[model samples]
Target: MAVDLNEFKHPSWITAAGAITGYLLILIVLTVALFIVPWLVFLAL
Candidate 1:
């Protein structure tokens, strides 16, 4: 199957927004997992 990058292009603003949103989501999840899991484990101990 052939994929075309041009066919997938959105408006520059939309593309930028999507990239920023994806990055924020990754950071939020990482922060929660890194801090929250250890705290929960300590509470259980």
Candidate 2:
């Protein structure tokens, strides 16, 4: 699916909030992965 970037140009605050939310979500996933990966590796051994 293709999205038009022009459609997203109207509201600046919404865009900024979305960007921040996406960034924080990614940060949280990575942080959880850091803890989970080691446990998985240890289980495999």
Candidate 3:
């Protein structure tokens, strides 16, 4: 499949902000999982 690069043109700051937001979201999910999973495991035992 051919992708068009022109369609992706945007300001550099916008892209950087998106990347930082994505990273923070991933960290939040991992932090929540770290707390929740152990509680679930303890409950299951």
Best by lDDT: 1
Model 1, position 29: C-alpha lDDT score:
97
For candidate 2, write residues 1-45 as lDDT tens digits. Answer: 999888667788688989999999999999779978888988999
Candidate 3 residues 1-45, lDDT tens each? Answer: 999887667688679889999999999999889998889999999
State the weakest 10-residue window (summed lDDT) of model 2: 5-14
Q: TM-score each candidate.
A: 0.70, 0.56, 0.57
Residue-wise C-alpha lDDT for candidate 1, range 1-45, written one tens digit per residue = 988788556698679989999999999999889998889999999
Model 1 clash pairs are: none
Off by over 4 Å in 2: 1-10, 36-45
Q: Superposing every Cα of model 2 onto the true structure, what RMSD results?
A: 6.0
Mark the 10 consecutive residues where model 1 has the least summed lDDT: 4-13
| Candidate 1 vs 3: which has more lDDT | 1
Q: Tell me how far the alpha carbon of residue 15 in candidate 1 is from the true structure, in angstroms, after superposition.
A: 0.6
> What would the TM-score be for candidate 3 when compared with the true structure?
0.57
* CA lDDT, every model vs. true structure: 0.90, 0.88, 0.88
